[model samples]
Target: MKKYAFAASAATIALAVSGQAFAQESDAFSTALADGAVTELAPVTVTTPLRRPTTVLQSTSTVTVITEDDIEKSAAPDLPSLLKRYPGVNITTNGGQGATSSIVLRGASASQTLVLIDGMRVASATSGTAYISNIPLSSIARVEIVEGAHSAEWGADAIGGVVNIITKDGSTCENGASVCTTVETGVTYPWGGYGTVSTRGVSNSGVNFNIGLSLLGTEGYDFTTADNSVHEDGRDGFLQGAFNFALSKDFLWGRLYTSGLYVRSNPHFDSAPYADWMTGETVYGANEADQTNAAFKVGAEVDHSDTWSSVFELYSAFDYQKNFRDGHPEADTHYDTNRYGLSASTTKEIQAGAALNTFTLGAEAYRETVDSSVEYTETARDVAAVYGQYGLELDALTFNAGLRYDYDEQFGDAVTYNVGLGYELVEGLTARASFSTGFNAPTFNDLYWAYDGSYVGNPDLEAETSKNWEVGLNWAPTDTAAIDLVYYENRIDDMIAYVSDPVTYIGTMENIDKAKVSGVRATYSQMLFDDRLGLDFGFEYRLPKDETDDVYIANQNRLKLTAEASYAATEKLNLNAGIEYVGSRWTNADNIEYTNYAQYQLGAYTLVNLSAIYAIDETANVKFAVENLFDEEYQTAYGYKAPGTTVTLAYRRTF
Candidate 1:
């Protein structure tokens, strides 16, 4: 019955698309389809905010868009490196490429940020976090970051914000039947070699498709050193591969699309006792770890009437990981997770007393399952949510309000809401304010896993909840310059943490903490010298504290500053440079006892990077980059040492 219902729904959407094609034609839709050739600086449409397509300038929330040109100019090796340049964003890595990386946005925990690929959630259900390190930049076309609570639109894990990645599509090519291919290869010391190949094309009938593949291998250095010794651990290594595909077609009604992404990586690290805080123990064994992440989605859109439009999609995602020590079968561990989802949304435009109003309604349903070697109290859960949003625009004043209700099999019910207001103070200045509520459900591992006596889960844990508010000002004084300033505060209750029982010293997940995070972020950018030179600056000051203990939050930097400058020396030559500063952080010492934790601080550091791209012609280019330009030694974590100065050289050819 369920299969039949799904098939019926898909058929209905296809028929709607066909019907709309015969009804009427819209120039707006045609312009949108042709926007693929537009410049990056132009206003772009995004759908993550309200589950309805809207221009960035029309959004009431603070947002940032990173385009393909920005990614190419940055010359970053991974997603973390590229994201570090943005304000209100922070990244920490255990080692080099393919290592475990964490992203903290606006003082929010790594798991609090919702990540999406092509409008489909792709994080691990057990861990409640996404392995963005495995995603290849070669396959990405753009990224949209909305900074604030977003549970009103997304059900869970949206306390910090949403990161939506859009991959390349064939529509990016010129009109008529066209095909394009790109190949790039590069090398950095210690890291042996990396290469990528991607192809995309568009048919005369408006059918578009794209495919990309990438591979990377590296002989990495030790990630950590001995507790009280100068000697470093053994060398770690990894090999990773990623693949992506996208297809789309434009009909009279709207556009229909399907996409998929797959990533596989194998990384080796030092084994337990050797890497652990123990004296006189030489590193002998290496642990092998394998990970795979995959996602697939199919969707369709259509215009029912001049004032009404709708979108429908079905998606599935899979995440798997396995670890082995010294190739011993007895010392093997594995975890696998899968998610299947269906969603639909509609937008309606109306006129009311000289004001224009837009209304959006959406519903989503998904089932998630986890399979692991270790026993779990519960292996699967179902979740369903319905949401609605309304926006009113009158002269220079804009107002938006939204609400969502979610029901989960494991955790009864949750309701969240958001309200926002925007006022145009002047021709070039705008003031905005927003208030929102967020919630995060406990992960499967946190609620049901039973690994050992030392580590256990608690099924009685409550959902973490938060209240957030922010105010901001945006000023574009001139065509070439713009500035943004924002201040935000977030208060979280029933925060989840790992706590140990005093009697047995067994660790389990608990809601025994609270946090208050407040911060100010500012960004400024300007283009000078006939648009030949560009300068951008960002500053952030965060005060993230644990209210339960009146102590600073662990692993969060209090202050951050970033600056970048780019110059088009000529039409064929371009130069770019950037600097980033991360403030001090507090964390427990490596050897601290679980019962009696001790805090330690790590000092701040700054890094510089430079890159240059010389175009051989319209179809080819060469790039040179230097990371950690000054070779300053630094550590984001207590024992982990960051990479030193490294150079990368690459050539890109397009046909």
Candidate 2:
């Protein structure tokens, strides 16, 4: 689940899902507060993950936080590329930038993981995937990644986990400043450039507001190789424009706020068309896609005390896309998916002797609809849910438990729950464990799409479900050093996938079989040399297996390792370097015909990046970065060429 913070006063406010940049004198992934430092962050979610105010160390689930400083240092132009640096995350893209991508968190498929921007959904119902490539990095301030099942708190589509992105609310201006604005521009390799402008201000009447704008475009390279016989090869291009707006006012009763983000992207991809397909000859076409993504929310928070509060909100989000092909207008298709919802919740805290206890109850309702060129049996579905949670913090023990009941118009009813506990074995060391259950609803395209030439839909598909078991430890023996390790196993039942008949080769969606994933993730962070140099290392080993076939999962890596270092070489220069390694993976789901499981595999590779920032003055700086310094050739999938070594140079100024 994601949490938001509401300022008690109008002057001190930040609008986001979670986190504060530079708040972590420690590892930003764990807790934000440093040793003996004041936790002066906004009042609520900058430290919370389960809807109430608490530090990251107090959370029972496996969590990772990427602050604004981390984002700026990565120098990644797209969201997917930036997310790959963290542990427990694996990315698989169809081609180069602006191509479709799958974010497999803890071995969960793209459709099973939930993504939120400022606590609202932006994924398409048809494909069950978010267009993360369309989300500009300039619009984000922080990101939180939670692993394992969490349907008890967030509802469906959380069978795997959740990714919550928080954007700037403009509270980071100079002390007591009434208005502030910043402009940034960059030129990147492989032919691309971008620019963004952001401003945040508060009025004397206690009305706060923020506005941001960004534009980006790239002249990409050929996505496919000549070895494939599908079509001709050429360059692909991508362009996007986006905006963000937020407004809030302090009232005597509560704080009222409204916020939204909108993005329009035009992307070109290699396709087969133009020439008549009935001729049975290969034909190349100039193809492009137009995509629109938007999300908005209006809400109010009322706080009577630090631990007692309530909130009410209404939200709407949608993702629409239409494709264009030369001389094949009739073959081009479009999909429009929309969602609208409302929620209300309240939390109460009680003090009994030395123990603090809290309880929460909430209810939510949402409707989803799809409009497309294909004729389908169903077009709309509705969902309603009620949930309750209880938490206890007594002495060295921390505990949490939640239960939820949901009713779906298409899938009937479901109930999920989780219980977790953390115990302090020593002054700075803690051990924790949890058990949870989650579910994922089948998309309309999977359940009711009309039959096409090669693909069809089955209406008997069930909502995929999962159960997870986890245990971990957090050790912070010193202020500058920290270690976190966790082991988790998740089993999914009735997993949904498209199945093709061996004889006819006609594909239809169905409940394939059972699948399981088990893994261990570990991280170590330290600072040295008068705290001027920082180092962080992360490693993950996972085993993804299909219970039905007793074979390894396809395209899921078993090993991943990363190392990052940052140093202040001088007063004016800051340097950062990183290295990442991903293990080889099989590209085919079935390997019965292959020998020693060696055929149809994507080889492993290592990538290195370097970045530097030189301060021209107090308010100005220049950013220079090199990605894939060695230009290692690799592919996430068959017949697609990954990006090569590239360089990016940029300038930034603050006012």
Candidate 3:
């Protein structure tokens, strides 16, 4: 590990100033810094704070931002790959590219994290998890991640945190119409090649559109070899396509904007059932899964007075999935979900004695419907909520308070609250603390799905609730350097889990007594060498446990560390590298009895990746990247093997 760090540092220094005369380009360097060439702290309009736009520094939350530049420079193959390096995030993929992946935030369950695309919640109603594997990087502009319970602001499934993906919009265009296209090709070790093509553009009239298509096929290696299973030995592949459009227009009284997205993916996987963990017998023939997601949103912002503003939005989204085996429908099973939402919010600002205050009030109503081949007691549900928040800002102190009440058709009603405070400790340092409550309703499958012999749903299950508290410090010692540290503890009650009957040995959804989760996260970023070099480091230690029985949580790492560096080696060439370390974790063995559960530990591993980009001209650029440079073998799950060394080459053009 030390040698890897030294090599990365040496490479960055040697490539950054190889033949350039440092003194001769002082004026150019200054101009570059002034022209936004250097990465600096920029204002972020985050809504997770209080369901209203607020700057990152002013909000009492831990946040991470992934910009367009970061995405482009990362050279990641998918959205999950790009997000895995961020602090407080962990990703588990069952196989190779285009595989089923799950994201865990701050050691929370994958279903506990809320995922939003352009202010619209997009997840499966039955599973309560988003398919991030299908989201193409070509259609995204930026991503904002808030790490902590936020149910007080956004009701339901927010016990872990919020991930808001902002897609590219026409407003990004500066002056005239611009067209951009990208082509990528890559290969996995001992497998096949993958290719992708995408085109995006923005018209001068604030109309933007994007279209992307990708194909990935691999003679995949057996991922279950770790468990001595030879059930699956065939190739796996996937095909995906995505489209996005957005339009905005300014009026005398307000602004109106609308956007839509559609994505489809078909991926092949093994037919082996999870219950046959150690069995080496082959299962069914080749299997494939199809999934589709579509969403549309329209909204308007109006200014009523100098101190008042209002917003109204309407949105609808849907998801559909189906599976097939050997070209024949399997179980005649398919799951389709639809959601519709309407919301309105207003902000009022007032001047008080020696202080300024802002108050926000909002109401939202949403309906979720599930149409599945599997029998269910209930197929549809509705939720309605009203929330309010107040903020006070003084010379060096800031305070916030919020409350929300939610009424569910199936679960009755729930109330949540949050309070926070921030004070300036010194000239360049600030201290902040917050306490919040969260809740997560049982999913349709968890509550209403009919008995399946092995498992059954329990409509009597109650909603899970959580309380969280955290304290943090933010310090910017210099214009080019910043550091953030946070310590947090979270307690959850009535956690949903599967329990088995002792006599019948039948599994059913139930609420666990309680769970305790705690963690500390720290991040540091600095700009060096006349703004030509960038360095970022992050570390997190988490203890997520099931307190009821002192059982270890599955697939949750205890420690995570990430380091990254980038260098603008020349006017047209750039180099970037990153390394990540995931500590040991525990997982349960398959078919284990509920009372005598067996767990196994997976050792820690480190991975390294490097990328280079060269600008051919103002309109064209090429990139090369190597993933898993060290070819380290590791597993996020007990029976799955992670990918190894691979290479990707891409070309992008703008006109």
TM-score of 3: 0.88
Best by TM-score: 2
Error at 91, model 1, angstroms: 0.9
Model 1 pairs in collision: none
Candidate 3 weakest ten by summed lDDT: 19-28
Encode model 3's per-residue lDDT on 434-498: one tens digit a residue: 99999888999999989888778899988899999999887766655566788999888999988
lDDT of 1: 0.75
* 295-341: candidate 1 lDDT, tens digit per residue: 89999988888899898999999889887766456668888999999
For candidate 1, give the lDDT of residue 103. Answer: 74
Cα lDDT tens digits, model 2, 1-655, are: 0011110111010111111111112123222221222233332243334655565555677777776666776756688878886778888876667877778789988888988888776778888988888788888877877788988888888877888887777564642468878789999888999999988888778778889999988898887766544444688888899999888997766799998899999888877545556987645443788989999999999987776889899999999998877676654778999999999999999999999998999999999999998787899999999998888989989998999999998878889999989888887677889899999998988988887877887878788999998998877667556667889999999999778989989899888788999999887766566445667778899999988888888888899998877766776777778888999988777844466333478889999988888878766778898888899898876777778877889998778
- Lowest lDDT sum, 10 consecutive residues, model 1, at 18-27
Give TM-scores for every candidate, taking all chains together and pairing residue i with residue i.
Answer: 0.89, 0.91, 0.88
- At residue 272, candidate 1 shows an lDDT of 55
Which runs in model 3 stand beyond 4 Å of their true positions? 1-42, 173-221, 226-230, 273-286, 589-599
Off by over 4 Å in 2: 1-49, 174-176, 229-231, 274-286, 501-505, 592-599
